[model samples]
Target: MKTTSITHRLADLGGAKWDLHTAARDRSDRGEDIVEMTIGEPDVALPEPLARAATRAIEAGRTQYSNGRGENGLRDALAESYSARRGRCFERDNVLCFPGTQTALYAVMQGVAETGDEVLVGDPLYATYEGVIRATGADMVPVPLKAEHGFRMQADDIAQRITERTRAILLNTPHNPTGAILRPAELEAIAEIALKHDLWLISDEVYEDLVFEGNSFTSPLTLEQIADRTIAVSSISKSHAAPGMRSGWAIGPRGFMDALLPVSETMLFGNQPFIADVTEEAVRAGSTVADGMRQRFAKRAQYLADRLEAETVLRVHRPEAGMFALVDVSPLGMDCDAFAWALLENAGVAVMPGSSFGAHLQNWVRLALTVEDAAMTKAVDRISEFARSVAVAAQ
Candidate 1:
């Protein structure tokens, strides 16, 4: 008998080696406190009402598996929530609930992407998109988002890259690693490409409510022409500050739900009823849950931007809106990976390398302002010290 190894498609996914667990363990072993600004973990508490709802559901013995499409009431509530919150309308039939947006994204990838099909992704994108695409045995074609363009993907560049092999376009609004939101004209252009290419438009709008600076999020689902081709993925993770709840939904056309349900069912039995019930309650509570979270993240974003501006070696892209700030560290003469490691080991501040998002950006780094204020401040202070030292040495 021959010994078998893991599959080939999973071989080249570099970022999945996120050793935060090992890093945390090493820090504990060294008895040194670390300030983490790498992971996008919300430091805020889940809405009080959501917590109460969860507690009530548990008390009411709502801890069983529910419909794969979600409980009827919860599904209806999600439709209403999206219309009122995101300005996107969909029938209850359009929504498919999942344990988390990650699952929803993965399901979409598996549903539409075939072996060796190509996925057009914005470079320096959310790191997970690469892994998900590869796991589906699809090729990831990274269309680099330029720093000069505020890290937003240009429609012309995306159009140039689309090939006959392309199956879908992956989009993340209020983009991770760079808090760049796509402008309306750019969005309309993308809609045109999707329509022209007859490709699936899978958008991760989990940060939909986190917009600021008067830059509202634009969802692909809102476009009438592109609506059928667009699969919208969102979660309570960022908006409700409820990552632990693991509640999310995918909304698209009725055919999408029909296709998605089988994949979701075969992989996950169903969305957790208790958590879904709580999320339903939170959504029904309307803007109170989502907008309040955005206001809190806005304050934190400003705090991080102020600190980065004081640093000499980092070229901070003060995000218009979102819970992350992108800093170009090319001036420090260090690649993103090396700088990230040095920040972790020397300064005790951990952040994500822009290279992890995609290949074109190896000199930029991302700081998640979602950490608690005191710790975030400490992380910024450490970053400032490192940047100052680099600047002085260059002089």
Candidate 2:
């Protein structure tokens, strides 16, 4: 008799981070102390305004299903807020809200590319991107982000990789793992490449609101030439510390959004109205909360980088924004996966191996600055000791 089988795309995908997270959780359940620095979740509390707004909506019975494109009021607020940030006017029709940024990204990929198409992505990218691209049946073409250049995706590199089959370029500013923020000129250059190749630009700006003092956040929508082809995906998850709310949206050309609506409908039907209402309030009034969290994360990133540099053999790549730093642990004479596993087993600390992001990052590890100061300090101390032990063993 024949047996049911999983699709090749799904079978080929790997969730290394989730696997490590589960391992860490299991160890903790067994009474071992585990300092989780594997995921990019914020340690901050959700802003009171968001919570209050959500409660008000729920009490007022605003729990019905919203339009697939989102409620008009929330879309209007997002349009106004994002227009101000991107320097481009966006109408309500330009937005499609999803349960989360991950869903938004997947829907956009499905709407833009089909099977046999190619999408260029930066190496050392967020791990889920590969799965999403594969799920859409589009081949993910990796454009190497050189560490020598701080892992910033160069426009020339993108231009060099484009083929007739290339449908889009996926970007994450203030990127995960590396936390390298793209400069305005770099964005402009990339925009030009997208225009030249007639390719779509999917810019994930979830970390836009978390930028540090010196760096500025520029949206791909700002480029008038590529505005029509660019889809800006963002959420209040990282910035407002509201991941559980699952509020996120994609802003693009109305035509593209029209095409994406069915995908969102099929995948999610629609987001909860209460969540959209809460998101609207968060967008309008939660800047102070977001700003305070960003400042704290920036400080935490610096503190962790400083500690790693002084205490451990790892070379830290201090991020300009976002909640993670990439540390080169090759000095310990082991690959990143080995180092991470050993650290988790021996030191009770869990960090993501850089190879989980991209093959080129095999000798690196990503440390999330989401833990409290005391825990972060203690985790670093354990990492330092582990590094020293490995070095001594090597000698």
Candidate 3:
């Protein structure tokens, strides 16, 4: 049997991107003491209101096939949420629901790009981004996100790389791996370029709810001039600590929705009604647990940065939002891969090498901030001690 090139390009459905983390899990399953910081998943349980909503929907016989786009309630709820937040007049017609942010992004890529087309994405982006773009037969053009800019994509850099083949710009805010949120001015400049080039702006905003106290999350869709060309995808996975629910949606121009409805149906007709009901509750009532997560993750990030700066050769780049922080390990004279693997093998600490995200992160290691307070304290202590030992060995 012949297979499509997508399978080869997907790299075993993107498992290759997480090989280190997978190996750590394998060891942990064998009863090793690995403090797994390799994944950015929320540690909290699903909010009670959402859980109750799903159960009630199931008990009330809501387990039927939904429409091609999505259930009206979830769509309407999402529309309302976006409208209120962005100050834009969105309707159900502008919403298309998928199981999660991953699927929504895949569909958007398929809609805006294809073979011979180039989609401009920031380097060291979310790990699965490479697969989704490649799966659409589009080349992902890496726009270097400079560490000096706190890893945020600069509009000038984006403009410099705009070739005629460029068809779309894929953006992740409160970005994965780095957790740097784009400022409104930067977003406005980028949006203007997208308009000037007549390219689609695909914004991945899944972590919008987890922003730290002093920072705010901005979306290109909020720029009124770019709304017609901008498509934003999000979910309750992080906000409600409900990743398993797999309820997500995209809000974009009506024309894009009109064209993408078939693509959405072709993949899967629609999501489960029970899940839709749960999602509707999540979007409408909002997540009470997100505030708590904001406090914990932000606290851990500061603690990680302060401890590393005070006690070791390592340096931490604290995140404005999201569940991960990057630690600079170049001072230890080891690449991030060597540093991460050695930390796991000798110190029982499992963190992701920054290179796994992309080349720009080659000198850094990213660690999840979702562990309990005591567990996180112990992990940081181990990392500090490991960093000192590595530095001494180099000395």
In model 1, which runs have C-alpha deviations exceeding 4 angstroms?
A: 1-6, 12-16, 85-89, 287-293
- Name every residue pair that clashes in candidate 2: none
lDDT of 2 by residue, 79-164 (tens): 99978887889989999998889989989999878888999999999988988898888899999998888899999899888999
Question: Roughly what TM-score does model 2 have, to 2 decimal places?
Answer: 0.96
Per-candidate TM equals: 0.92, 0.96, 0.98
Compared with the true structure, what per-residue lDDT tens digits does model 1 show for residues 313-365? Answer: 57778776667887788888888888888878778887777777778778888
In model 3, which regions exceed 4 Å deviation?
none
Where does candidate 1 clash, by residue pair?
none
Candidate 2 vs candidate 3: the lDDT winner is: 3
On lDDT, the leading prediction is 3
Name the top TM-score candidate.
3
The C-alpha lDDT values of all candidates are 0.81, 0.87, 0.91
